[model samples]
Each structure stands twice: as structure tokens, then as C-alpha cells.
Target: MLHPEDVPTLREREHGRNLEGCCGPHGGTGPNLACPCGSLVATLLADCLGPWEVRLHPLRTWAHDPTGA
Candidate 1:
């Protein structure tokens, strides 16, 4: 699980993707985060009853260093 602050490009998904919890989002249904280009990328679990974190989809993400370091 990744911190929401670690992924600044992801935004809350619309159309009920964040409607699985009472206080916040449970993130058990499916991807609830999208990229700047509007592509589903990860699931955000921030419900008041569970651990809060962002789970990224393995097939939808990768690591890179613009500095080539």
C-alpha cells in the first residue's frame, strides 16, 4: 500500500467508484483512482473503519527516474 501523498498524479475516480464506505471509500469494489489523463490506476482505502492507503495496480504502473540516477 502506498500513501496518497506519494502519488500526486492520481485523483478520485467518479461515477460511484468511491461509494463503497460509510465515512469514506473502502476501496474493495475496484480501482478508485485515476491518472491525470483519466485512466483508472489504483484503489484508495480511506474508510473510517479501516487502514487508509492507496493500492496501485501492478499491471497499470511502473517506476522511473527522470534524473536517470
Candidate 2:
């Protein structure tokens, strides 16, 4: 799990693969041991991290997205 501060609370879709920071034992601050976004984590945690957050499909939603993505 990521330390509350470093977590973006949401992720954007990268089509097939979206590897952001690492959600490994050391978290995003350490070496990236695994991909932290998409179906991988969703299968493990039962919730797709990408779709759970604000989606970039809408331009009006950008400001509320907080990701600046």
C-alpha cells in the first residue's frame, strides 16, 4: 500500500497498459517492482484503480480530476 501522502487517489487509462509509480512493498518512493495501475492491481484488490478515479474522457472534468493528467 502507498503512504497516504504519495497516493494519487486515482489513475488515468493508458489504453492497454498504464504503469504509474510502483505499489510494491516499498511503495512509489522506492524502485518500481510492479505496475501500480490497471487490471493487475484490480485483480489483486478487486477494484480497478484506473476506473475508480476521475476519468480523462471529459475535458470539463480535468480541473476536478486533480491528476492534471
Question: TM-scores, in order shown?
Answer: 0.86, 0.16
- Residues 1-69, candidate 1, lDDT per residue (tens digit)? 898899898899877656579888988788889999998989999899988899999899888899999
Model 2 regions lying over 4 Å from their true place: 1-16, 24-52, 59-69
Candidate 2 per-residue lDDT over residues 1-69, each given as its tens digit:
333234354432344233343441212222222224442221112133322222222322223456866
Query: Which clashing pairs does model 1 show?
Result: none
Per-model C-alpha lDDT, please?
A: 0.87, 0.29
Q: Report the C-alpha displacement of residue 1, candidate 2, in angstroms.
A: 22
Worst lDDT 10-window in candidate 2: 24-33
